[model samples]
Target: MLALRRSLIALVAIVGVVAGAVTAWVVTEASDGGAHATRGEAAIGGPFELVNTEGETVTDQDFRGRYMLLFFGFTSCPDVCPSALMDMSRALDRLADAAPAKLERVVPVFVTVDPARDDVVTMAAYVENFHPRLVGLTGTPAQLRAAADAFRVYHEKVMPETYFGGDAPERHEKGDYMMAHSAYMLLIGPSGGYVANFKHEAGPAEIAAGLREHVDAS
Candidate 1:
């Protein structure tokens, strides 16, 4: 749980840098802070459909035979999203070197919470910044919301005061908003059930270690 708190701290810091009007408390309040907690498997993960970067429709069933490391964020997220993707890539690379066979059974997935701005092409380009095997997914707002709910992930957009020129509640451009979401990397079992999760503070080595432990146990 401490690790999750740390992840939230880093996410809030990134949001603050992008939109000075955001505060750490605002982000903390937005997050449920229990994404990676030990809860009933029923509490997380379920059926959902979305489009991959290749414009192909995918679902939880498509990844049924492999472990899924999922992260929810947006392409517009300047720091947390990119950093988490890089961490996932590095963790996968470590796994490939240490346990090649186990690595083959793991899949890293990125699902965009802000689908309005992240289409198939945008997700394709954004995913390229990380691992070659990473799958980037985006879909309609309703579709994305379904997936987020299935995962019990929290996400919401905040219109920063800076966009309003320091005026309180003034109208701003539609795209001038920041997202506050959970920043944990969720690990789903091969059967599409909940396994465990790694907080951003865990970094590459810790993430790789967690994957190795879970994959070997199964």
Candidate 2:
């Protein structure tokens, strides 16, 4: 009985050690970056159905056979959104200057987080402020939410009272609001899968270099 008891205790100890090792491996994988990071297919980018500035319904499939430079922001965003969009536009221009032929292989997309105020006409005019080839998209709340979820983009409307030190903006009405959102320029492959993303701090040259690397790889 004593020997049997000892054997059972040893087995249990072995099992616990194995479980601990597995858990540690998973944690390391989750935290590790560089080549060890796990990037599964369709993990970052997923299917989404949205309406373009032209008032036409489109999906991820529509942009298939070409790369997509996707960005999510609202027209009312005064700083971060505009800076990122400018960087994206200049990146494309740089790429074009180096290899004009590569321009046709990629499409720059702007998705609005505030669809309530960003209709087709608004998006059309907003996109014109950036690159001519840039495409702006908006849709219903449900559609926008779905797209945001797929891309892991977070956005929320900030009331006027929250804009300053607990003081509302002058003439701010009930409907007046601003948005707080994640600002990252996502790069989708020609196969409609996520390739990479650039932070808003990345300048035009850096973004262009990174984008050029992907285009060359493709």
Candidate 3:
């Protein structure tokens, strides 16, 4: 019985490691070049209804005639979220300088994973700090989940203790928690299909180039 239990534990550990490795490989490949090349066959992205910064309900259909550059994150994120948004903003700026007309056809959107704290007013204020053309979106938990699911985004709330460990500061309130989420930005075509993904590490110029290629082709 003891031997069997040990064997099961070992098998579980191995499976966990393999799953993590596979996930990392998929994300890396998607970010590198596979996403663009496999866009036609990729099943990512679909219909979603969410609220805009103006408190008006909006759907994916509203963006049917234009390309959508979508990102998922929260406003209060201390580092990753803000950095990713800044990179996206810079990429758009680069695109504007290269192809002004194409820039007009692409809409950069920020969707908050923490809808409870990211109301329309909060979204509006947060998005304004990024690209002028960037639109902020937040909705009820169910609505946001639908949108996140459509894009295969991963997000989970983590308490400071779990996220920061024993070194966690005392300044965090009892309800204060952080979100762990996927950092990739997704590109959707004018007809509401997945195009490609940009890794968080992808720089402004690379993203701009990708945008120019896809927008020009579309």
The most accurate candidate by TM-score is 3
TM-score of each model, paired residue for residue: 0.77, 0.78, 0.80
Scored by lDDT, model 1 comes in at 0.78
Model 3 off-target regions past 4 Å? 1-40
Candidate 3 residue-wise lDDT, 1-218, digit = tens: 32342344334334433343344333325655565322123556789999998889999999988999998989987667788899999999999899999998999999999998999999999999999999999999999999987777777898867555444578878889977677778789998877777776688999999999898533
Q: Which pairs in model 2 have colliding backbones?
A: none
lDDT of 1 by residue, 122-195 (tens): 99998998998999999999999999877767788866453223442434455488676777788898888778
Give the Cα-based TM-score of candidate 3 against the true structure: 0.80
| Candidate 2 lDDT tens digits, 54-91 | 89999999998898998899997766778789999999
TM-score pick, better of 2 and 3: 3
Q: How many clashes would you count in candidate 2?
A: 0
RMSD of 3: 10.1
